[model samples]
Target chain A: MRIAFGGNQAGFWWYMAAGAVLLLAFAGIGLFRGAVPIDEGDVLAVLARHLLPGERAADPSVDTIVWSLRAPRVVVAAMVGGCLALAGAQMQGLFRNPLASPGIVGTSTGAAAGAVFALTFGLAGTFLLAAPLFAVAGALLSLLIVTRIATRDGYTPVTTLLLAGVALNALLAAFNSWLIARSWEQYEAARRIAYWMMGGVTDRGWVHVGMVLPGMVIGCAIAVWFARDLDLLLEGEEVAASLGVDIEKTKRAVLWSAAILTGSAVAVSGVVGFVGLVVPHLVRLLLGPVHRRLLPAAFLTGAWFVVGADLLARTLVAPEEVFLGVVTAFVGAPFFLFLLVRHESEVAVSR
Target chain B: MMETRGSARRAPRLELVDGGVERRGRWLLRDVDLVIEPAMLTSVVGPNGAGKSTLLRLLSGTWRLTEGKALLGGFDLSALPRRQAARRVAYVPQTVRPTFEFTVREFVTLGRYPHESRLFGTRSADRGWIDRCLDDTDVLALAERRVTTLSGGELQRVLMARCLATEAEVLLLDEPTSNLDLAHGLDLLGLARRLACEGRSVVLVLHDLNAAARFADRVAVLDGGALIAEGPPAEVLNPDLLRRVFRVEAVPLEGSTAPVFDFEPLR
Candidate 1:
């Protein structure tokens, strides 16, 4: 069950170095691999010019492509990926289940329902921020309901939380489907809803980056601060409480932070799947389960995964972009199956 | 180490006065009056559903008494801050299955959580205590191994070491030897005795009557959520009480420090 990744200290640094290199490489691919070809040298020149003062740009068009169009999208993708993966890791630790993610607790579906509702009612068109705002609202509301239902005597049981999440997911997904069905008569509305449901990072600009960055930073910081407590909590609720962890408080804090992270990511990226579920599991498999290491490793790995997946989505079938979620699932589903098999055998051996 | 030895001068006297717990419209325990003094090993023994574990929970501050109050070191148990109370009392349950892989050292270091500052790293004093606990429980050799890879006996000792790492005056252990073999069980009990000898109060919930008689300085028998008897092992453990409370006949072997009882059904 325990996959030894070299030694603990040296392996951790090595993974960090490798992950940083991979992230930069993927970010480079994301920046330049589009319909309009931009040279890597040109991109670097523009970046240096922007950093320095009074430097003549090689080409304004290239600068625009790198800074105005591609940079924002790439940054947004990284932020959303890091946010969801960090949230997923926190959820797994909070529930003490490897399978737990933002989607498991209905947060993603709830946000989707909120966005769909906003779009169907024309609220999104009226207010530019309405869709993301409503999505965040829905995610937080669902988290509150789940927390309320799962809690008894100030303690939230994992079984009760999961059951509540399942029920809520069913109800929210049905509501989303109902909204889509009701708006089927309108072609434009139906198309928007359908495309949003498919999930993508295309055309996301600096505003989208701004919308999700604060939550990502705050949530990741909070998660890291509580990483030690999460390690103790994985043992069990009673053990954590006996070790002076305010169990109820810690659980509530972690759940809410996850909701924030998931809500913002879903708002910007439109319900991207598999990144949150697969990235954390992959990191834990490669590294060990210590949250101090797991959290940062998951964040970097998730950023790389989304950027790479987004690049493939844009380039695989030239000029016709594929949905980001579709590409991630195409790759992540088989890995998920492999993880399940490995997890099963690990459990068997441990038992 | 010197700090702990010096602070050991004031050993807390844990007392329960008319303490009772009710759950789901039923009383799990009531009118339980017991005093746990320092430097003593007290064993609570009864058949299933006798509220032995519930009493330990109450003492550990995990459960609230619906009536009356329990006091730890003269402060009401409910009034103490959770971290402060945790620093005073440590509780070890029957078994804990960790979902993540933590080394034995990492698992034992959790015991020092209450003593460390919230934002800072581990205190040097706390680290010393953790290492001492590992050495004391004879788990130093297993410190680097993953807890999941440990045997049941090794796991129990590791958990015991964790409890000791807290440096708490009182330990509430609920069936520490339940899944352990006879030799491991005796080793755990002997460790408990050693803890008591070092000015710590150890309250153990034991299902084995002979082990309780063998290791406990005091034995409290619970029947139907009430304390049926509380006294020294020789005073409380006897043929008549065993027959009355446990519905068994006790055949005591002679020439032992504490009588070893061989139970036969009442039929």
Candidate 2:
């Protein structure tokens, strides 16, 4: 009968500390254990040198590998994971269902389609902004479409939204395939499209980190701003409205912020599945459903989840690296199925 | 016992002037004019699907006024800002099932949202009011219990505590006793009557005519979304009116403090 997260202050802090420690450990493994063998001390020395400007590390080669190659990739991977998880939490709150996520609702695939189009048509030629811009546009457009289709009399039913997302995801994936086929003569473009569809964080640089970090920060801030409203909304739309929450405004802000977060994530790492779905669910399991705690916990857990998954992807096959999306699916699909079965059983038992 | 607290202040009035609601080209309710005054418990009695819930929704400002105006304290309900309207009226629906497991205290604290300035944290002063509301509703013992774990009657009291925490002058409850047993149902009605005596307007949509007649200062009979009769319970609880509005034969038991009707199928 005791309150879990909101009431147990000390326990909540402990949960947060656990998540932080796990994230740091995963980040350490990501930086130290990669294709090139770099010792922990060397990685720390390289970081110290960068911080102090004059402190030199053990080896120049180790510094390059840690700072230029692995560091940026790890940072981007964490950012993408954090963003997707936060977006997923927001989507779940908005829909009032645990099953709702950006990926399930077609936001990620829509962004991927936009980025692929920009890449295939050379619309992003030499401009780092173009691809992300297109991705954001695509994500927002699809979000608007799905919300519009599902909303009736100022309410959006979860089932209708999920169905709309399924149909939209298929249509967008097919369009992406058509674009890929059209660019078959251009081997470079075709190759990029193929890699993007599978999704990865290979060769990612500071530019990608810069592109996503700001969006994540803003999106998270927006999510926190609407956290209380989200809790009231979990009861029902009528109840939320009676509680002084402007349901329409909250819905628009939440959907747009989630779209921006999902778009930035897909722009950097194409359609990394299950981080959005699984990380938030994990956080909810640990820290009840209170968004004030749930949002931050999900962000941290999601970053750790992706960083850890990416580490496994890089080292699991030794010489050959697996795609980030593939690793997530391998781990996430089973977790998702378990969740579905558990949810069904719970529903049955309750009935 | 009915007790009025605080200094004398004019309680707000909620009036519906020919209020009507239409949905998708079908009129759910129409030409309903009513005035809910302070220091009174008004029970709205009706058959199933008689737009009783719709009437409460209109007063709560959740449903739009399709034809007429709902005025709260001389200001148009639809024109008032949401927070302002919420500050004046608190609504407890028939049932609310939260997706998350919020403790009773945490759920009750949500009532202070309109008064709190910050998005996430609660003000220190708000805690006292929350505790007082819980005590008032006799749910203080269940404060730490998860709402999902509470029984139907316990959850109803917790929800009532939440409504009281809003500190609004008017309370609109839709079927507050639908899931309660006889003892709990009477306890809730008693609480509603006491709340009315404290200078708050209490409007309840009820199914049990005897309970409505026992607790309500005034009773309004609604049939087919229209007001058929409105008066004191002594005048409104007659057999003919019951037969006309509810399509039932009412046998009033004698030697009761208040008229209690046992309904039978109309022949």
Candidate 3:
């Protein structure tokens, strides 16, 4: 047990360092890569000297691409990634089911529904915050409905929760599609909606970061603060009660926090799939299930993952810009499948 | 020593009911009056569904009496906060099945929740107590092992360790050794006896009459939710009462500490 605790602490620190290193490397790659593909020499010259028109021989085009577009995209991607993963972790803890995912549970679908409605009706043009605010409200409402229905008789069984999420997601998807069909005049709006739904950091700015920052901070803080209670809750309701966990109160707090983080990520970068579902499990596998360590570590790793994935999304099909969600699911799905196959015994044990 | 002082100062555990209803319309337990002493082993035993578990739940403050007061340590069980009751009485359910893989240490540390300060992480004393509890229950060696992987007997020990970590003098166990082998069953009974000897009050529900007669200082028999017999095992285990309640011809053998029952074969 002592060794396991020590090992957990070690793993947590290692993940934090690795995440930081990866983010730094991605930021470097973002800075140096360009139409001319500036190498380390050019990057160094630009950094050491201002590299003005007459001062030094470094590409200004590279600087502009690196500092302006690429930098903002990376930051926003990191923020979105962290938010989604942290939200997922909190949701998993909230529902006490590892399989619980924000998108699968209708939060993302609700956000999509709200966003498509906003775009189709020109609400974004009418109001500055209308798109995000409506999306947030919709996500919260869907989550509230799910939570209410799942917990009608005091406790939420895993199967009921998963089924409810699937049903709600399907329902919301239908609404989103209907909204798109009705807004035929807004052809561009439909295309943009589809693109956003696929998720990207293209043309993202510091404004996106500013919009999501507060929600992420508040939601993640709440997740960390209640991590202990979540750990107790994993033991089940009766055991949790015996251990002094106020299940009802904690349940409300967790759902609220998860909704905020998830909605903010969706509102900021559109629906990025599988980040929340995949990241927490990764953290759990590397580190033990103690949330005190798990939440912070997951947050960092998620940020790195999102930023890295965004980098790949931008560079993979250069000039075309592959969707962030597509790449994430492409990689995440296989990993998740492997995890499902490998952890079948564990899953059976939990059941 | 503090537990002894606390128990000594504590008022007798009481159950007062105007009307406490059960699952069925039948009043399993009516307006009952009972007082339980501290630092003693009290066994609750009866036929299946005699409301023994119900009374234990009421006493442990898990379930509130519908019309009357259930008191523990001079506080109304219903009115008293769950944390407060948990600090005084540790409850162990019959079946312990954790849905997740919780290590033994992790499971035991849950008992320290009521004791640990909210803002501060686990204190040195809390950790010390947890370690001691694990050692006492002989689960220290298995602290790293997942509770889901434990044998029934090992899990029982881990649960007992958790109860001990609660630091509560009053331990209420619902059929703790029901699934255990003979050795494990006797071991748990012995542990309960030891706790009582150490001045910690223990209330257990035992289905096995032999185990109850062997370990409990006093046995309380409930029939249809009412306390029908409450006294020494010798006084309570009579063939007349056994036949009336159990509907079986029980020949009680003498001299043995455990009540050996020989049923006359149906001819």
Candidate 4:
């Protein structure tokens, strides 16, 4: 395929280099902040003490605070962010529409519904990973329903799929609201569920990290494994099949991967919106759409976006931390509307 | 100005024995018995809804036959792996509107997917075969241009180039000229004729009777889901057969090697 957008002839290495620099820069900035007063060197020392053998920080209590408390929050934020964006890119490719995202596809909302179900129904008391595991089931279920409604004779039209997904998203959100309302009399449960639904990684520890990281990493690996087929699939399924692609097999594998990625992220962080939508679109603008490059770049950029968003969430209000989802929606919703408008006008022009 | 290179690598024999496909209790195509041989440009001519496109799909193995056997070189097409089937039969659809922007080079390179062994051999960029395909289709100059940016005629040539990259023995094209202007349509049909002359079977789903008659070595005429006439252009595309099957009268130009026909609907 030709280089998309033509203006950005800058190759993958340049994108990776620029992205890595910015990601590390934001992550460095993320490491230095918190309710506790920790500087850059202290942050580095805490990291060194954990990663390198026998290295010690000057202040042990500060080390305990940052390493045991603050570090996992930042790490989990990055992982969930990367997974959301990676899933978004795959969704976009699958539907052959840039508008396709985890949020749009109902995966995030479904997971949110499941997590809320766990929290209100008191399944969080059953096991440590109960809520997240339930969220995965919800995500997979919603995706299955939406695809079933949209697919006909092995062909899924973008318009029909989008309509189905949007409907499912609305339905799941209503279900979540019903859960919240039913448990409103339990003051503590309602507040906790509401806060969780707003999406954050505030007190997420290494355990939360362990829970989502493996599944997410494996999902990304599966995505990269089918990267070439993903690229050809952008040409549309019939064409891809003519080029020897196993259309149904490829679709099932990638959708399963996307669902897993979305579920893992939403399981931990509630319904964080649009990092998947915006990050992949931006990456494609810079590096073009060869999934081998697009997937990794989108992951890194998404990680950076959320890490930055989380940093802003904590420090932007200074002690009155904003919801992580609110911060992302503030930035992402406007961009999505712009894309939709552009899409509408393009359709008009084509007609 | 296209150079005709005839490296005919043992073109495969394609035969359809009573092939039929039904959908929703209706036979879109029934009993299509067509034998496609090497070094022949067979134009499948018919009125609208005559199942010309359906026949091409059956031959490409994109759509399966519900009734009879479809074979490529004596092996059942359904039994062959998708990649092996692709290696034997290449298909060019009527219109390709890819939403993603891929370069002409990349688009053509996709044809090499079937030849790539064991799935995941993108490391060795086979520029030789790709460039040769581009050169043959006369789009070497437009290699760097994005496919989305191409004009109708240029993109058609690019599609032909992509098909060439497959190195398949049989080429199935559906309404190749349906979207083109006069000159470009003739140019595309000429390219198809040259490929057939160089020893590969090329089948076309064509609507224009004169264009088909001009280039086809044989014309297979279909009406109401079955083959009505199949032979040399003069025999199959005569005014009487044309009037009966296509419901049109034609002033047949039969003096030249490549004939032309002017037709009007029989009211």
Question: How many residue pairs clash per model?
Answer: 0, 0, 0, 6
Q: Mind sharing the TM-score for model 4?
A: 0.94
Every model's TM-score: 0.95, 0.94, 0.88, 0.94
CA displacement after TM-score superposition, residue B216 of candidate 4 (Å): 1.3
Worst 10 residues of 2 chain A by lDDT: A1-10
Top candidate when judged by DockQ against the true structure? 2
Q: Output the better candidate (3/4) by TM-score.
A: 4
Which stretches of candidate 3 lie above 4 Å from their native place? A1-8, A34-64, A103-105, A148-166, A345-351, B1-32, B223-226, B263-267
Backbone clash pairs in model 4 (N, Cα, C under 3 Å; residues 3+ apart or in different chains), count? 6
* Root-mean-square deviation per candidate: 2.4, 2.5, 4.3, 2.6
- Pairs that clash in candidate 2: none
lDDT of 2 by residue, B1-267 (tens): 212233224469898999999988888889999998777999999998888999999998878989999999888999988877887889998986655778789899888777867553777778887888888888888898778778889999888888887788889999999999988888889888888887889999999999988899999888887877887899888999899888999998888878788889999
lDDT of 1 by residue, B1-267 (tens): 111222354359998889999999999999999999878999999989999988998898877899979899788988888788898899987786555677788789888888877667477788777788888778888987888788888899899889988878899999999979988888889888877877889999999999999899999999999989998999999999999899998998877879688889998
What is the per-residue lDDT of model 4 for residues A220-306, given as tens digits with 9 covering 90 to 100? 878987878877788767677777888777877788899999999989988788898998887775566767778998999999889
Candidate 3 lDDT by residue in tens digits, B69-92 = 777666677787777777877888
Higher-DockQ candidate of 2 and 3: 2
Let me know the DockQ for model 1. Answer: 0.57
Model 1 agreement with the true structure over A191-309: per-residue lDDT tens digits: 98888888888888889998998878778878877887887788888887877788878887888888989998998789788888888887877776778789998998888889888
Q: What TM-score does structure 1 among the candidates reach?
A: 0.95
Best by TM-score: 1
